[model samples]
Target chain A: MLKDITIGQYFPGNSVIHRMDPRMKIVLSIAYIVMLFMAKGFSGLAVGVVFLAICYGVSHIPVSLILKSLKPVVPIILFTAVLNMFFVEGDPLFQWAFITITKQGLSTAALMSVRIVCLIAGTSLLTYTTSPIVLTDGIERLLSPLKKLHLPVHELAMMMTIALRFIPTLIEETDKIMSAQKARGADLESGGLVQRAKALVPILIPLFISAFRRADDLALAMECRCYRGGEGRTRMKQLKLTSRDIVGAIIVALTIVAIILLNIFFPLAIA
Target chain B: MAAITVEHLSHVYSQGTPFEKTAVDDVSLTIEEGEFVGVIGHTGSGKSTLIQHFNGLLKPTSGRILVEDRDMWADPKKIREFRFKVGLVFQYPEYQLFEETVAKDIAFGPSNMGLSPEEVQMRVQQAAQFVGLRADKLEKSPFELSGGQKRRVAIAGVMAMNPKVLILDEPTAGLDPRGRDKVLGEIKQYHKTQGNTVLLVSHSMEDIARYADRVLVMNKGKVAMFDTTENVFARSEELAAMGLAVPQVSRICRGLAARGLNIDPNCYTIEQAKQQLLALRAGKGADQNA
Candidate 1:
């Protein structure tokens, strides 16, 4: 049952986006998200799509895999699209007995759906190209400013890093536990709701106990190694932005500017 | 009846994806009832995947797993029954113990089988006894028990189901020498008393050699060899080449045999080696009568 989980998740690549400093990639991901939202019209949306596509291509993550990653969200996408199609006010596109779909609503829903898809695909590129450790390190560094605003950025990043590192380890542990229980005839599947949930108690209780034990061991080991909080911790591999990052940033900046220009010149198409 | 029969079993995880790799290639083997079979292989040689097929815990990407001549996936709904028929205690069994008390933990399995509350209690008690767990430890939380005790509780959880074919993957792993011996002894007793088929998967050839009557060797997802323990151990070189060692005693005998002393390299147990050495000594003494 646990084997269905995807691990060994970080795709190996040497593309331009992969070569960018993780810190830059993290920054660019946030910037791309901001652009996705600030995007005013279809033209702006098109720019975001084009830019994300370029990033995805540069990261060397197959477009098919990115689409596959979207599989879990297809239902949500459809729901949001249906809601948008019925709610937004504009010229009517089609009408059924009690339901009217507007032209404006259709366009808005299509644009919003595409935006959501691009946002996900763009972020996935970050996760796919950059290892979890680097991503967390980038997050910690980027959020360092918010540290003054009581964000606990360091702690959160540390948690994420530790959590990511232990994902495979805990997955392995869960696999062992599942096999052990399955061997004992713990019918994890093929039961009524309550029965199945009750069956999970055996698996969960043990996993929770071990998780706590692991946490304690980790804390003790950290103390033994004199690991203080992020106060003065020196990174073994410091982040450095390079020429590729500059080129990528310039290209992204130009795309955004062009999007804004198109929004001004062709305001009605966007409006 | 054959306890478990896997025919042309193959599994490729994440099939059609770039990450897809065959964890278990085409492999076929039959484990007969009341037999003690040892499965030895390197870490990724597919031992775990193979045993998983026995209980229908994992569906083979292709091929069939038969339990008592019935295909495990015949009904698909009967996989749970298959699990009860073929027990699998994975490595580090302690990771599966979650009940408040050892007693409840041991009872978890039989209860899942839709057994009566009373029958579940009986099986739990009997299984704990089978694994040499003390009556007093039954009330203690599984988390509070020592590693070895937790291990027994985990194993007892499965044994409570009273499976026809019991498969243990490294039952004594990470245990101290004494703990290892006790666990192994209890498992052997359980197998003997129940007269159940046993499949032991271990990296340590000594563990397999000591208890297993038959052995199956896996390499690169295929069966390298499968035969009586004696015959399998005879190919010590091939096993060694696969990074699997022979039983320590058999290995020692081989070294002695290389020094011009006549002996059987097929003896896997220490007792057999000791008896052979004594017989040779007696023969040498009788030769002086000439």
Candidate 2:
């Protein structure tokens, strides 16, 4: 059941989005988020929606997967929409006893919901396309300039890469440990909150011990290979920005310009 | 009555996802009560997945598993009871030991069954004795013990439950030869004393030939054969085709037979092979005298 997590999940493909330089993808994703917030009304948000749709189309990721990524954020979207709907005061569109659905409130709620959905969809697309190792490499390269301030950028990136690499291994271990405990009649499903938490003691202790053991072994293995703090290190796959990355940056710039124009020229009627 | 029954069992990992793959296909088998069955298979042949169904640790994607003639997942909520009926000791179970004391680790199983403290203590002592763990060492922390000792403790933890059926998946993996023999001997003795059904999954054909009453051969998620140990070992070529082999003694006997000697190719155990060679020599001597 733990395998259902779509966070940090990478769907591998040979599409243009997947092949784009990871550094370019990360920068464009941040730029897209900024554009979404800059959007003033439905017309401005429509630009983001169109750009996102086109990106997904080229990436070849299935619609079901995109929907799966949005599933966990449904409650957050609803909460934001409801807070905007009833709490904001303006010209009342509909009135009951104490609650007033104002004209401005409805427009703001719709706009916020559209913006939040587009934000999630756009960002998840980046993770879906870029592999985790490449993503970390991209981040480290982008942060390389901070070395002038004596920051341990490479060490931090190495730590993140190692942590990401061990997630699936640790998850497999957890499943094995849980099954081993259950075979001995460990009741993890039914109980009060305290009882359930107490039952996890059997699982947690073993998991922690195994994880530490793995880390120790990994460190030893790295040392045996003459690893020394990422200094003077060489990479197997060098990151290079091809024409695909350049074209993607241009498309993103155009989308941002379109959002700016729409924000100025076309505002929602109610707003 | 059969101790465990699997009907058309199939398990698919990550179903409906792009990573979907069937780990176990449409397989059916029944293990009789008080029978010691050795399951032989290559890695990824679904040996582990198939046994996990016996105790409802994994629900089959399209089949039913019955323990002691009752459908394991019929109630779903009461499935824990089946775990107590069929105990599973996973591969390298020594890594699962987490208690402060060896005594406490063995008691984990019985205590989880809601047994009284006294009953739990009694069962823990019995299990420890069965696994040859001394009374004095019971108070020591399990983490401080040697690898073989920790493995025994993990086995005792499950044995304390006194399940009607015990399934072990490569329990001797990563152990020394002596350690492997000790653990396997303890399990054989436990089966004899308790008269419970036992399924031992191993890659070592010699070990299975030494202890198993019957052998079950699995290949590519299907039961290729299930028969008496002698019968399974006799078909060495067929077994070799499945990436398995008979005991080394049996292979030697087969070679002798191929060389026109009157040796039984089905002789698996060392004792049996010795007896066969002795009989063949005696018969030759008598014929020469005639």
Candidate 3:
């Protein structure tokens, strides 16, 4: 059950998106999200949707996987849509007592939901294409400018990379502990809310202890290796921008321009 | 009647996904009551997965597991009863210790069995004694104990339940030689005094040779051989092909047999090899005197 979490999961592939520079992918993802919100009318949203569809095709990631990433945010999406539908004021599309669903409200709700879905899909595509190590490297390189202000950019990136590396290890340990407790007749399933919370005591205490132990071991190992605050460390694989990254950046720029032009030509219906 | 019976049992992990794998496949075996059966296999050969089924921890995808002539999954609600009947001490069980005191950790299983508090305390003391834990250490927190002592406390936790069959998966793994021997000796003593079935899963052929009366060899999720310890070691070459080795003494006996000695090649223990060599020496001495 703990294995179902796919956050920050990278799928290994040889597609163009996978080959693009990590920094370029990260920048392009931020740009995509910006354009999604900047989009004013149906035409702009359509352009964003088409752009995502093309990215999905080029990345070769299955549609089902992209949909699965949205599972955890379903409630948030529904809440936002419902709020927009009831609150936005305009000509009434349907009237029922004080709760009137206006034409503009309905349109705004649809647009908001579309924008949120596109936002999630675009960001997940970035994680799906770039490995965590490369992503951290990209972030460290991008944030290196802040080093002049003594912000410890490299140290932050190193911590993130280590955290990502240990996620699966900790998950495996939890699974083993759960099994051990179950063998001792600890009923984790089929209980009231209070009973279920009580059952977690057996699992949580051991997990926390092991996690602390692992952290101590890791710190000792790092010290033994003379690791001192990520200074003077050189990467074996330096980041290089290739033709694919240049082409991806150009496409993102063009999409942003197109969204702006579409918004100017076809004004939003809600406003 | 057999204490446990596995009929054409097969298990596939993550079925219908791309990562699906047949961890245990079409395997079948029967273990009788009061018999000590040692399961030996290379890593990922289904040794752990198979033992988990004995206590209904894992359900077979294609076959059945019977504990004392009753299907383990016949009544899903009663699966907890099987856990009480078959105690499983998983690898590195020390990490499972969570109680504040060593005594409470040991009593976890017995209390879960709904026994009276006095009976739970009695079983806790007995289990701790079986693992050679000193009585004075019972009041201390488990985390305060040493590594080996923590492991003993974990084992006692399972033993307190007084299962009819005890299954240990590499109970001696990651322990020093002395610690390993202590744990194995306690397990042997448990089996001897309780006179109940014990299934020991290990990768050390020597440990099995010394303690197990019967050996079950698993290769690529299939039972390669299941027979007496002597017979299993006699086929050392076959075991070697499966990336397993026999006891050092058994290897020496086979080496001597290859050199045309009249000694038995199936000697699986040091005592057996010593007796054979002594008899051979006596025969030589008599021939010289004659």
Candidate 4:
């Protein structure tokens, strides 16, 4: 059951997007998120959606995965959409007891839903195409300038790398513990809220104990290997921007510029 | 009656995804009640997956698992009850211990069975005793105990449930030779006194040779062989072809036989080897008199 979580999930591939520099991918993903918010109407949001679709195509990620990434955000999308539909005041389309639907509300809801979907899809693309280690390395390199400010960017990235590395291990451990407890007749399902929370005691305590033990072992092993933080560390796979990354950067930059221009030149029809 | 019956069992992990792979495929086997069966397989050969089905920990994708003639997934709601009937001690089970005191950790299983408090307490004491955990150690926190002791506590926790069928996956893995023998010996004694079906999953051929009445060999998610221990070890060539070996005694006996010694190549245990060599010496003395 714990295997269903899709955190830091990287789909192995040799596509153009997969080959693009991780730093550029992270930067462009942030740019894409910004473009989604910058988009003022359907016209601007449409550009963002089109750019994301093009990315999905280039990355060779299946459409099913794109839909899967959007599953978790469906509640948020519905929430904002429903709130906007009922709360916004514009041309009234329907009325029922104190609830009213407005044409402007409908338009806003549509725009918000599209923006949120595009927002998640765009960022998840980054994770899907880039491995966690490479992604952390990119972030560490990108944030290296902050070392001048006495920031512990290397340590932060190292922690992220370790956390990502152990996610599958911890997940497997949790699965084992759950099965062990289940075999002991622990009823994890079909209980009152209090009973359910109480049942988690067995699973959680063991999970925490095992996780801490693993962390302790990792620290010892790292020390044994002479790992003294990331100071003066040389990477074997250096993040160098290739022509593909340059082209990706240009496309993302052009998309953001286009969204801004679309917002300025073509406002919503209602306005 | 069979303690557990698997019919055409097939399990696919992460089904329908690109990562989907069949871990167990179209396998069927029946384990008679009160039988000590040893399961051997290479890593990722479906040994774990197949046993998980015995206790309803995993539902087969396209098959049925019957525990004492009852379909495990018949109700799905009562599957937890079946767990009490068939206990599974996972690999590195010591990591599953959570209660503050060793006694409480042992009681976790019996208490979960919804037995009376007195019954739970009694079972805890009996289980701890069975696993050779001393009375004084029961009150101490399980975490304070050594690794082997903690593992004993974990096994006792399952034993406290008094499951009719006990399945342990690599119970003695990562233990020293003495610790390994101690744990296996305790389990063998438990099986003897309880007269319950026990499925022992181990990588050690010698352990199986010593304790298991029947050995089930799995290869590439299918049952390779299921027969008496003597018969399984007798076919060392077939076993070696599947990346497995018979016990060291059997190999040594085979070496002796190849060198023209009157040794039984089928002997799989040190006791059997000694008896065979002694009898051979007596025969040699008789031949000299003739």
Candidate 5:
């Protein structure tokens, strides 16, 4: 049933974070990702955690929802943690046959897991809070300055918006296609890997054809509506960086600064 | 025993999410064997959702669907068997036909059922015959067929399975009147020959009245009414309130009845109206001549 797919999901809200100019939010998200990496020692990681906590609190998005998004990536997180714990060479903390857990290895494992989790969480918050339309609109405007370099920013953004908008459409189409094939006794979920993959051909072929047809129709419809490449296309809602966005950016920047200073000035306890 | 029995079924889509919605509220119905049942509702009235459950295509959020008294979801793993038992033709089924040749496409279901190649070939020919697909067209690529033909071929894929309960969700949709009649005629013929239960979900009131013996009117995810065509069409006002119209001819008859005509206001078909009018005229003539 492909139930666990959480991509392109949005959380509708009236929080200050949700209302911010998506352009400002996008840039701030980048800053937050950097701050996550900058955090090294325990003090530094603490600052990163507090900053992420503040962002989450302001967004008004439930903690459980964020944790739910982390479900799909749990195995990856564990893999990274285990790899760091067992592979990194340092003073041995626990010697168990061939695999040795070192003090530095454990610390690296902990910090890396935290960094990866925070990175995913921060990026996801932007998507979860801001509607895809607004996000794409902001991206188009931000990338407009690059049009002189022939970057096709408008086209790219338009494509992204259309793709984001059609995620549900495609999912519904897939469900329909699955049902259609199922009526014909297509046993998609059962069988071995090869059989399963073969079964998906019926679904995938129809889906691909339909997607292409939809794109063609959408293009024609866009032309009919006189949507000519974002040129002179005035948005109904203009993007403006509010005080909340500026304040959020400032907090994130300060956290990064504190992490850098902590790494520079303090000796690590584990070391 | 009825071919299909739904017992107090309810469905909530995306349950527990902020965008959660209840599509079908508690609805129970029994579709008698060999009877043609039409499910009519406004868009999102859960007609589609309800039909999906009847065939085991969808697992109900709560409640049971019984195909000849056997629970549909008793073993979810064997849902494929249920599908063969209840053939579901989804709207725009042509889009689902992926095989290269018409014969191959029609044989998909029987082939998937692990039938022998010879039996699948026989079923394909029989299914094509049932849908009135020409023998010459069997070898052609499905993409070469016209819209209506493609729909038939898609439908034939399921019909090839020889299901006991055949359900079609808007089989005649997007087709011209001639095309619609062709498809409907085939469905009625299929029911007559197969002696199986037929559940048709459609938005067209006329189509339902024309073919279905019993009509289940869905309104806001609940069974608003379940009765014979004559009775259901008689409650035109209630249907109107639910944003559904009575059959076209019945609407006209009701309008005429309201304006002091001694016509049968409950008649929903053209043939019924004609017979009633002839009787009315005969009665008037008898009075005048006497």
Candidate 6:
């Protein structure tokens, strides 16, 4: 029953986005998010919508998957939209006993909802196209400059890679343990709050024990391989920015510039 | 009466997505009460997925499962009770133990059934005895026990529920020879004494040949063969084609048969092979005397 989580999952594909340099993809993802926040009106949001559509088309990732990633944050989107609709004060469109709806509030609410959806879709594209190993490699390389400040960049990346690799293993282990417990009639579904929390005792204890056991084994295996921290380590696949990456960067730069110009020149009527 | 019946059952994993694939496909079988059935298949052949359906652990994508002629999904609310009646001990069950003491761990199932404390204690002791665990060891923490001992405790935990039809998925997996024998022996004893149905899922043909009365051969998510142990082993070549093999004794018998010896190729155990060889010798001696 714990299999519904799709966060941090990567989809394998042979698209241009997948082929781009991982570091460039990371930068573009951050740039896309910043562009969404910088946008002000319908014309600006239109740029984001067009950019995301182009990305979806080029990545070959199904639109449904991008929407699936937004499922968990749907409540937050709705909550913000509702709050903005009723709380913002401007030319009132409708007035009730204790509530008033304004044109500005309605416009702000629409803009906020569109911005949130675009923001999630844009970031999800990064993870969908790039594998975890490549993503971490990119992150470690990007953060390498911070080593001058004594930050453990390589170690942190190593930890993240290990964690990502074990997610599926731990999930499969948890599934097995849950089935074993359920076969013995452990009531996990029906119970009060306290009873439910108590039921987790049987699952949690075993899970924690196995996790530690796995960690110990991994440490031993790493020691056997002489894995001395990230110092002087060489990678088999070097990350290099090619002509395609430069062209992609140019397109993103042009899109961001166009968004800024559009926000300045083609402001929405409500704003 | 059939202890369990699967009718045209099919299970698809991650349906409606790119990962959609059928794990079990239109499989149907009937298991009689008090019978020991062995399910053999290669990895990803749907052996694990099929057994999980017996206890309502997995809902069939199409068709139904009947336990004692009653539809298992007829009353979804009481499905937990069905689990008590059809206990499933998964592979590497030792990892499921969590209670502080072995006794409490064994009692977990019975307590979940809301039995009286006294009855729970009685069942726990009975299960421990069945598994060859000493009474004194019950007070110790489960974490303190060795790997094989911890596995026994986990098995006893399910046995404490006294399920009518016990399904074990590779119970002997990862155990040493002696440990494997001990666990399999206890399962045989439990079936014999309690007269309850047992479904053993294993990849080892020898284990099934020695213990199972009937064998169910699964191939590519379908039931390829289901018959008496002798009959299934008789078609060892077909099993081999499916990436399975017969017992070593059966292979030896097949070799003798190939050399024109009048021995049954289906002789699986050592005792059967010995008798076949002795009979062949007697017939040869009689012919020479004539």
Q: TM-score for all predictions?
A: 0.90, 0.95, 0.97, 0.94, 0.92, 0.93
Candidate 3 chain A worst ten-residue window by lDDT: A1-10
Q: Which ten residues in a row have the lowest lDDT in candidate 2 chain A?
A: A1-10
- Candidate 2 regions off by >4 Å? A267-271, B14-20, B278-290
Question: Candidate 5 clash total?
Answer: 0
Tens digits of per-residue lDDT for model 2, B148-229 = 9999999999999999999999999999999999999999999999999999999999899999999999899899999999
lDDT of 1: 0.85
Name every residue pair that clashes in candidate 4: none
Higher-scoring candidate on DockQ, 1 or 2: 2
On residues B87-137, what C-alpha lDDT tens digit does candidate 4 reach at each position? 999999999999999999999999888899999999999999899999999
Question: DockQ (Cα-based) per candidate?
Answer: 0.73, 0.78, 0.84, 0.84, 0.73, 0.84
Model 1's DockQ score = 0.73
lDDT of 1 by residue, A187-225 (tens): 776769988888788778778888998999999999999
TM-score of 1: 0.90
Superposed Cα deviation of residue B226, candidate 5 (Å): 2.8
lDDT of 3 by residue, A1-271 (tens): 6786665779889999998889888889999999998999988999999999999998899999989988888899899999999999999989988899989999999998999999998999989999999999999998899999999999999999999999998899999999999999988887899999999999999999999999999999999998888688887998999988898899989999999998898886867
Give the number of the best model, judged by TM-score.
Answer: 3
True contacts preserved, each candidate? 0.94, 0.88, 0.71, 0.94, 0.86, 1.00
Off by over 4 Å in 5: A1-4, A87-90, A96-98, B16-21, B257-262, B279-290
Query: Which scores higher on lDDT, 3 or 5?
Result: 3
Q: What are the per-residue Cα lDDT tens digits for candidate 4 across A130-238?
A: 9999999999999999999999999999999999999999998888888889988889987899999999999999999989989999999999999998788887887
Superposed on all Cα atoms, the candidates' RMSDs to the truth, in angstroms, are: 2.9, 2.2, 1.5, 2.2, 2.6, 2.5
**Residue-level lDDT for B39 in candidate 1:** 91
Instruction: Give the lDDT of residue A197 in candidate 5.
Output: 96
Candidate 5 residue-wise lDDT at A211: 93
What would the per-residue lDDT of candidate 6 be over residues A236-262, giving only the tens digit for each residue?
999999998999999989889988998
In candidate 6, residue B179 scores what lDDT? 98
Q: What is the lDDT of residue A181 in candidate 3?
A: 96
CAPRI tier of model 3? high
Chain B vs. true chain B: TM-score per candidate: 0.97, 0.97, 0.98, 0.98, 0.96, 0.96
Q: Could you give candidate 2's per-residue lDDT for residues A151-232 as a string of tens digits?
A: 9999999999999999888888988999999999999998899999999999999999999999999999999999998679
Better of 1 and 4 by DockQ: 4
